[model samples]
Target: MKAAAETMPTLRAKHVTPHAFRHATAVHLISAGVDVTVIRSWLGHVSLDTTNHYARANLETKRKALEKVTAPTTPGGQPSWKRNASVLAWLDTL
Candidate 1:
């Protein structure tokens, strides 16, 4: 298999493995916004619990998620953190 892989430029003879391909497929599907339950079924996972590991957000994904969110503000239209700063600081000390 290694020799055959070497003849094919795209195949990394030393690095290719079934698990790597499966993992890559999972990550690709996740980035494409495929549902976790569907991904689990596609990967032949017996339970959604097993698929949760692949569904975890990496730092880049988390950053993108945070970017999409609006910061919390009080009814007065001021950012909550601005009003709470002193109280939060006191709580932190405790």
Candidate 2:
């Protein structure tokens, strides 16, 4: 810690720890579109719920998901399923 502080003065006053580094790494991985299950395995967490703690989506992530939901399924405004009567009937059964 002393040697690192000598070269980088900014870190000298900050209280950084191994756990802080681990948390930051997790958040970065999540932001990079890595799967949460993969992150859980890498972090050695036993539960997916624990990993979900680090998977909270930021505004950008939420916006991307919303865009996917609102985006057209086909180049035309109509959905592909609407063109297929059997598929539409199957969906209606649900």
Highest lDDT model number: 2
Clashing pairs in 2: none
User: Which 10 residues in a row give candidate 2 its minimum summed lDDT?
Assistant: 70-79
lDDT tens digits, residue span 1-94, model 1: 6676678866763677789889988987887789999999999999889998898887777887889999765687876765788977987899
Q: Model-by-model lDDT, in order?
A: 0.83, 0.90
The C-alpha RMSD in Å for every predicted model, in order, reads: 4.7, 6.3
lDDT of 1: 0.83
Q: How does each model score on TM-score?
A: 0.64, 0.59
Clashing pairs in 1: none
Give per-residue CA lDDT, model 2, range 1-94, as digits (tens).
Answer: 7889999989889999999999989988998899999999999999999999999988877887887786545756678778889998999999
- Where model 2 places Cα greater than 4 Å from the true spot, the runs are 1-8, 63-94
